[model samples]
Target: MKASRVASARSWLRTSNVPSDEYLEGIYYVQGRDFVDAGIVSSEIKKNLKEKGIPESIIRKVAVVTFEAEVNIISYAEQGTIQYYVEPGSITIEAKDIGIGIEDIELAQQEGYSTADDSIREMGFGAGMGLANIRKYSDEFEITSVPKEGTYLRSTIYVNGK
Candidate 1:
């Protein structure tokens, strides 16, 4: 049963009117509650981008990158903020959280290092691949953390005018 849930095809997206660039640049906050809520928000962003005439390639590119942010917030923080910038040239997604906070940013970004407990591993999340996957798909990435303070993760996805 648990295995089935992890393997289920994940499609996160919803459609609404595409907001103007000025509006997209505004800050937004999303609370963390496991994977479900993050997935919903991610889907909406994808839909927003698609409505802006962003190509499939660019839309998917942004989706994968931000999905990492969504997962990071949901998995690590009790709540998170999505402050974003949707511009003509690129989209910047900033996901911030105050949680247990990463003690070692370097180790966390490694492809196989995670602090997630056993239960997280059972859900197929603690593969130590979250940050690595985010970097692999993003055009620019940076992470800053302070012990007991929280973490600030920012990623920039440039459309390359596709």
Candidate 2:
């Protein structure tokens, strides 16, 4: 099941969208147990982008990237924020959390390396693919964490695939 999810993410990244140069952006406040709320916000953004003539492919990338980031926060952080930016050159998705930060970012990035306990695992989440999927679907990715401070993850998907 995890393999299939990963494969599906890979497929999302493979699609291409027509390049845009206009700047667009949105911000979302993410709370724990609010995946549905996040999804609604994401869908609105996707719809807006599509109406603006942003290709479906690019919108899909934004959805996938944002969903992964949101899920990570929902599963791990007590609270967090997800920011979306649609620039002329690229789309940027950032997740910032105020909770126990990642102790080893390197290990966290590795596929199948998860810290989710039995409770989270029992829910069929925390396969440790969140960060990996975010990185895989993005053209540029960066992550930072401070023990007890929190974690910040950002991913950029270029409009022109640059």
Q: Which segments of model 2 are wrong by more than 4 Å? A: 1-21, 35-38, 122-124
**Candidate 1, which segments miss by more than 4 Å at Cα?**
1-18, 21-23, 26-28, 33-35
* lDDT values for all models: 0.70, 0.74
Q: Cα RMSD to native, each candidate?
A: 5.7, 9.1
Scored by Cα lDDT, where does model 2 land?
A: 0.74
* Model 1 residue pairs with clashes: 12-43, 13-43
Tens-place lDDT per residue, model 1, 1-162, is: 544443332222222334564445434455544554446566767767776677788788778777777777777876667666777778887888987789989889989997777656555577889899888877888899987777898888787842
Candidate 1, residue 162: the lDDT equals: 26
Model 2 reaches what TM-score against the true structure?
0.78
TM-score of each: 0.79, 0.78
What does the lDDT read for residue 20 in candidate 2?
51
Residue-wise C-alpha lDDT for candidate 2, range 1-162, written one tens digit per residue: 655644443333222234454666666666654433435445656776777777777788888888777777767787777777777778888889998889999999999999877656665567988788888889999999998888999889887775
